[model samples]
Target: MGGVYVLGGDWLPDAGNRKVLTELPPQLAEARVCGLMQTRRREWDGAVVRDVLSERDARLVLTIPLSTQERRDSLYWMAEKRGRFTVRSCYRELVGEYEGDGWMGWTKRLLANAEALRNRWVECSRICPLCDEEEETSVHVFFTCRVAQRCWAKVRVEFAGDVRQSIQTAFQYMFSVMDADRLGFALIVCWSLWQCRNGAVWRGEAVTED
Candidate 1:
C-alpha cells in the first residue's frame, strides 16, 4: 500500500458510490486539480477541504513528488552539508547556533566589560561606576544598579519583583515583551550607560543624571 504515490494517475480508486475514499481523490491530490475542484464546490465545502489539507500529516504527503524513473531509495542525513554525517556536523547539530539579532552584540560587550572588571583585567574601581553602591558585576551593572534603575524608569519599564539573576534572563524578558523599537531604545540606554561608565573611570569625569 506504501510505494511512491503518483498524484494525477491511479492514486485513487474509481468508486463514485463512496462518500469518503480511503485514498485521496485525484482531484484533491494535485494542487491545480484541487484548485479547480474547490472553485466548483460550495464555499463551506472548499473551506473544509482546505482545513484538511492544511493539517501537518496531510501537508507532508503533498511534498512527495511523483516519480518518473524508478531509482533505489537511500537514506540521507539532512543536518550534514552533503547528506553525509561528519563529527563536525554532528557537533553543530547538537549545539545549534546563536540566531539572536539586534541588541545581542551590545549585550555581549556589556558582559565582557563585567567579566573584565571581575577578573581585574581592567584597572578601575570595583564598585559600579554608575551607582557606586555595589560590586560591579553583569547583573548588578545592567539590572540592579540604582542608576540603571533610574534609566529604566525613564523608559517606564518595571524591573522589580523576583529580580533576574543573569543577563540571559533579563534579555529574554525584554525581548518577549518589547517590540523592535522598544528593544532598540533599551539597548541604546545600556550603551550610553556603558559609555558614561567608561568616561567616569578613564577620564575621571563626573556622573550626571542627564
Candidate 2:
C-alpha cells in the first residue's frame, strides 16, 4: 500500500521500500506499466518516471535491465543454491529449528564436509574453508573451528571444551540424551554451520553474519 508495486510494472521494487508516494497522479500511480517505455526504445521513459516519483525511486525503474529478446519470467528461492524450496531450507527459514531435517544429518556425518569427500578419493583439500585452520571433519566444522565458536558466541551459548571433546567419541549418544532445549539450540547452530560450510565450499561465499 506504500506504492512499492504497480499492477503490471516493468520494475521490481525493493522489498523494504515503504516510501509514501504523493507525487504521482492517481491514473499514473495505479496504471499498469505496459507502455512506460518510449515509443521505440528498450529504456524507460525518463520524464514520466521522474514526474511520478522522487528522484531516488525513479532511478530504480530507470536502471531496470531491459532486453529486446522475448523471455518468460521465472521464480527462484534465494535461500538455496538450486533456487527451489525444500523441507530443509523451508524449515530453517520458518522455524529456525530444522526440527528433524538434515540438521540431524549433521550429527550422522553424512553430508559432504571436505574431509569426508577427500576420503572417498575425491580430489579436494580437506581443510575447512570457513576456518582455514583444521580439516573439515564433521566434528571440526560443527565444533572445534573458530567460525563455529563464533556462531555459538553470537547466540550467547557457551559449550564447555568437553562438549566438543566428548562429541568426538559419542556425538550421537550425547544428542540423543541432551536436554530438549539445549538439543534444539545445538541443532539450530549446526544448521548455520552447515549453511556456512556449503556457502564457503560451493559458492565461495563465506557467511560471517550471525
- What TM-score would you give candidate 1 relative to the actual structure? 0.44
Among these predicted structures, which one has the highest lDDT? 2
After TM-score superposition, what is the CA distance of residue 101 in candidate 1 from its true location, in Å? Answer: 12
Clashing pairs counted in every model: 0, 0
TM-score of 2: 0.46
Provide the overall lDDT of each model, using Cα atoms, as 2-decimal numbers: 0.54, 0.60
The ten-residue window of minimal lDDT in model 2 covers 1-10
Q: Can you write out model 1's per-residue Cα lDDT over 1-210, one digit (the tens) per residue?
A: 123233422232221111122356566564432331224432223444445443442333343343344455444445564668453344233223435765454455544455566675766567777777788877776667888888888987665455467776776666577666666566656655765676676656688776
Candidate 1: worst-modelled 10 consecutive residues by lDDT: 12-21
RMSD (Cα, Å) of model 2: 13.0
